[model samples]
Target: MRELERYYRVLELEPGASLDEVNQAYKDLAFVWHPDRMPQDNQRLKDKAVSKLQQINEARDKLRSHKARLHVPSTRAASQSASNPTSQQTTTSKTTSRQAYSSQSRTPQEPSYQPPKPHPDLTGKDYSGANLTNRDFSGRNMSYANLKGANLSDTFMHKVNLFGADLSEANLFRANLLLADLREANLQSANLIGADLSGADLRGADLRGARVMIGDRVQVKLIGALLNGAIMPDGSIHE
Candidate 1:
């Protein structure tokens, strides 16, 4: 059965497309959906770009592998031919039986490999106290997400929209949160050791009692971030 239709659809081509066609189609779509072309502030477009690029890559690979496999000789057919040279000259009555055997030995129909489903949509979702260590949540819209007491250590959250999200008591050790919009976020008692918050928007964010220091030295990075009305790691607040 032809299970390659999905690949063709991804490439915007009809079934029975040549291998060359698939390669060209992937290039065309990737160029159009690439995230670099989108505006820096457009988080929605960037997320879409990441998901689209992944699908295009998978489609091209599946089609190319299938084509390559078709060219390889069947080991079972070759072995049968070598073992039954005398039987190859079968009578007319036995010719039908050989044809049936050859058909049975044909290459099996293998399903194409599809990548696992993408991460769940976290838009305004409640995930308080979730252990989400080392996860990649870059370029996502997690506005108002309830992340209180969540372990987000080493997570990638670049350019994410976490406006009004509750990140109280979250562990963000060594996390990459560059250029994230954390306006009005609650970071009370969160462990931000070695976390990068460069170019982030911390306007009105509450960071009181946050673990942002290591032996009197600040372990958090906040270069180019907006801190209007934000509470500092200490008891004082930023005017």
Candidate 2:
């Protein structure tokens, strides 16, 4: 058995779990195995608590990615349908019918399957200049994380908390950053072309010299958000 196996047992779940089951399991186990719940008298127990927390976080990430992959095909189809809106609907209907039949043929009371875990120490790590294109970071708490100069083209960051994060010079072209909190974040010289910033809290964020397209829809909350030196989609500068 692996070291993380102990953590899986603590959560009373197998290592290979589906995303839905991973979310539910994390909620249940966090209530019991939280560091606050453990006594601080023994150093060994405290260490164990830390290890368990890392394991749980890793498991959740793995499951989330696995679940996200399952929806990719459907997403691509939907994107195509949005462009055509005619022939794709017929194909979609047939596919949906086949999927319904497949689901019914499967076991009625199906248990959730577990997926692989992620690296334990990914949070707050420096990921400068990394290629993170088309990645999903939805609902993740990445406060104070350093993503400077990272390539995040076409990524999805919906509702992610990025307070005080460093994202300077990052490439966020065509990214969906809807409802993300970028308070006090450093986004100097970052690319926001075609990025959806609707409902984003950009309070105290540095947008000086940032490349922002005018065609992209951005609902700015703060008054002092710098519009100078921003490149609009109309091929004009947002002065």
Candidate 3:
């Protein structure tokens, strides 16, 4: 179990840590060690960060796959998600989950809940391979929307609500998504090259295997997004 031990060590977890713990540790460490957050002039640190990120990714992948075989208590979530795939797309009310509020990016004093927008109602809408480039959909609630393989390049989606939207393998290159609410969104393998997500909320969002960066140091998609508590492509969370 040398390899297993290495994985656990890389994620900073005790050996035989549960799936939840592994996932959580990966997120936490990713946030603290992402290359983009590092100083630009520190080439040595950047190189080290790159290496660390790679090890973290490998650890998460192996451990997750290993945990899948055990089907432990946490496997219930995976089973449930498989049974009701739409469950992953449910629009989680911020006020409803008190635990989420405890770790919110917003300051304890700020009270700007909004310009109340509509509840996300686009459940399971398929827009596969569609060219939706440059269309404006700011501030609209689109929770559970299925936009797999869609071309969203140059789209104006500032402050739009995309909670739990599925954009897997979608083309979001150069899209302008400033302040967009993308909480719990699925963007696995999406092409996010040149996408602008400055100040966007990305808590609990999945970005596995996405083309988000040009190099080890450059942040292509997450240039200015509010990544606090966001889950990255490598299963790490941004602080």
Candidate 4:
């Protein structure tokens, strides 16, 4: 019981908090204590953040496991109650009627996917290893930001300023970077698979070992963009 309470306290939640609340608290705390949010020069703070994140993750996992174990007993009781011959017949009848009614009713269609609204200017922010998939960050000034190892899959960053940003090892899978300013950005070993870089300025950017091609065919667009002094995927320096 004391251990359980400790986990809840780690997540900043009260005892007996609902699973939804626990999950939400975990997400919020993870974002707050993520190492990328701290200054790279500050090793002390960054180490603390890393330690906090690990604790948060552990707390969340333990709480979830406890919740699952608690749920199993209730489910077993429900099953035992339903196993009685009289109760089984009644349940079957009710289930058949409900299924018939549901068949007659029109099924609701799932909502279409909507792009995320624009956020305030995120210039120079640290979002390393963050899951920002399918978001629209078009025209945002994120210059010199630390986005190393961030998940930017399917993100629309058209015309965004990422000048000199540390994007090494970041996942840019299918991201839209049309006309964006990526001058001198560190993209070493980054995943640029299926990314749209049409007309984007990547002058002097480090692309060594970055995946910009698939099987000898260039999969990314560099139409009319500057690559002066940038390193190519093959470890060759671009002229």
How much is 106 displaced in model 3, in angstroms? 56
Number of the top lDDT candidate: 1
Candidate 3 per-residue lDDT, tens place, 73-138, comes to 333443443454343454454233433434452444544333336655555667778899866676
Ranking by TM-score: 1, 4, 3, 2
Off by over 4 Å in 1: 1-109, 113-120
Candidate 2 lDDT tens digits, 103-215: 65455344344445762434576878999986667677887889999998877776677887888899988776667788777888888776666567776666665776455
Tens digit per residue, CA lDDT, model 1, 1-239:
26688888988989878977887787667656756545568899989999999989988999888877766556676457545646556576466656766666665563334544876668789888898986768888999999999999877788889999999999999887878999999999999998888789999999999998889788887877899999887867798
Decide which is better by lDDT, 3 or 4. 4
Give residue 211's error in model 2 in angstroms: 0.3
After TM-score superposition, what is the CA distance of residue 51 in candidate 2 from its true location, in Å? 42
Candidate 2 has a TM-score of 0.43
Error of 3 at 230 (Å): 2.6
Q: Residue 93 deviation, candidate 2, in Å?
A: 56
Q: What ordering of candidates by lDDT runs from best to worst?
A: 1, 4, 3, 2
Q: Which is the leading candidate under TM-score?
A: 1
* Candidate 2: segments with Cα more than 4 A from true spot: 1-112, 115-123, 214-239
Q: Per-prediction TM-score, please?
A: 0.55, 0.43, 0.47, 0.50
**What residue pairs clash in candidate 2, if any at all?**
16-114, 17-113, 17-114, 17-115, 18-113, 214-232, 214-233
Between candidates 2 and 4, name the one with more favorable TM-score.
Answer: 4
